[model samples]
Target: MSSWEIHAIKYADRNARVRGDSFVFDDNHDAPHPMDYFMWLLRRGEEVILVDTGYDDAEAAARARPIRLDPVVALAPLGVRPDQITKVIVTHLHYDHAGGLRLFPNATLHMQAAEMAYATGPCMCHDTLRMPFTADHVCEAVTRLFSGQVVFHDGDGQVAEGVTVHRIGGHSRGLQAVRVRTESGWMVLASDAAHFYENLFARKPFPIVVDVQDMLDGFDRLLGLASRPELIIPGHDPLVCKLFAPGVADHIRRLDPGPTGKVPR
Candidate 1:
């Protein structure tokens, strides 16, 4: 298997109160459940794959989610130019995940067929289900679809030599996660499938769920796909920023532990 360098670029975060039952399904605690937003960058040799194009300032202002930096701009520190990105794997069409699609003009978008149908389907006619999606974000995807920029998948498939995308619809109808073969092992990017480490480790589902059963099953799928528990990274967990590559000034983390036993010095 080919190994690649993976980096999670955190753009925004929020500290808010969350009800345990809503998030955990059974637990009853109501306390602060901090969440972070990020977009991942994967590089191997000359190929670059971006996972989830995070939302912009307008969406943040509308949703009242705090914004620190634009995800596209955040890539500057990693020496990645927007035009150089060839493939962008959208985990789902949630505004926070797919809003920045326009930034990468040259990339081919990868999305699950079920997810696109869900976003544009009659299910979104309901307010509760449509709240997480932004009209413009979904519309932009439609525009891309018409332009032949989208590569839609019915289920699971390899994204590249070492990267693969798997469908695990729960958080969203078309929700998917990316798994990359790295020096450490297979690191599964459990975007929204497991919002935080607690959600996965405790089998606690996050509040924003489409199908409880799908969400629960996705946890098992993630475990089976990953090489190890530690290698499976959560989508919005603040702990990820700290644990992966804490001391670095920039958020970029070299996931592959090369010959030195550590990728980053």
Candidate 2:
């Protein structure tokens, strides 16, 4: 298997949030709990794979969530253009993660079959259930589907040599996590599987959940997919920037650890 280099590109954030907003049950529910939005980049040799394009300006305006930088502009410093991305793995069709589908015009989208069905299905009729999704984003995905630019994975599917996606339907009907073979070992990008370390460590599910039992099961699934607890990257914790790749000041942080016995220092 080819080892890959993973980078988390921070795009937007929600600062005025509390513990209660993040966790279903927490003692310090009144305490502050900020979220940092990110879109991961996985690269090896000449292969470039993107995971979950962050929301765009329109989404930002509608949701009242301001973006620090445009995701396309965020990629320029890294030398990756939106059109250059060949494969984009959308963990789920949540507004924050899948709103930028129109930006990547040439890339083939990879998503779980259930997610597509759920996003377009009757479940969206409920206001509470569909709050996290945007209609135009779903429409864009449908357009891509008709254009033959979408690949629907039933469950577990491989995107590249060492990159694979696993279906864990808790947060969404088809929410999946990306597991990549890295220098350290297997690293699982737990996109909304655990919004924060405490979400998994404390065994508490996020408030915005579709199925309570499945959300709890997904936490276990994230732990099982990763090589270790440390290798599992949470979806939206700001601590991720500090915990991984210390001394780096930029928004894009390196996630893969060094070899088994080798630390970054």
Kindly give the number of clashing pairs for every candidate.
1, 0
User: What tens digits encode model 1's per-residue C-alpha lDDT throughout 1-265?
Assistant: 5689887888887777565623765555776677888898898878889999898898888989867888777888887888998899999998899988888878889999999999999999999999989988888888988888999988798889988999999889899999999988888999999988778878888878889899999999999999877788889877776676532336555555522222111
98-124: candidate 2 lDDT, tens digit per residue: 988899999899999999999999999
After superposition, which runs of candidate 2 have C-alpha atoms over 4 Å from their true positions? Answer: 246-249, 258-265
For every candidate, C-alpha RMSD to the true structure in Å: 3.5, 2.8
- Model 2: worst 10 consecutive residues (lDDT sum): 256-265
Whole-model lDDT per candidate: 0.83, 0.88
lDDT of 2: 0.88
Instruction: Give the 10-residue window scoring lowest on summed lDDT in candidate 1.
Output: 256-265
For model 1, state the Cα shift of residue 102 in Å.
1.4
Give each model a TM-score.
0.92, 0.95
> Against the true structure, candidate 1 has what lDDT?
0.83
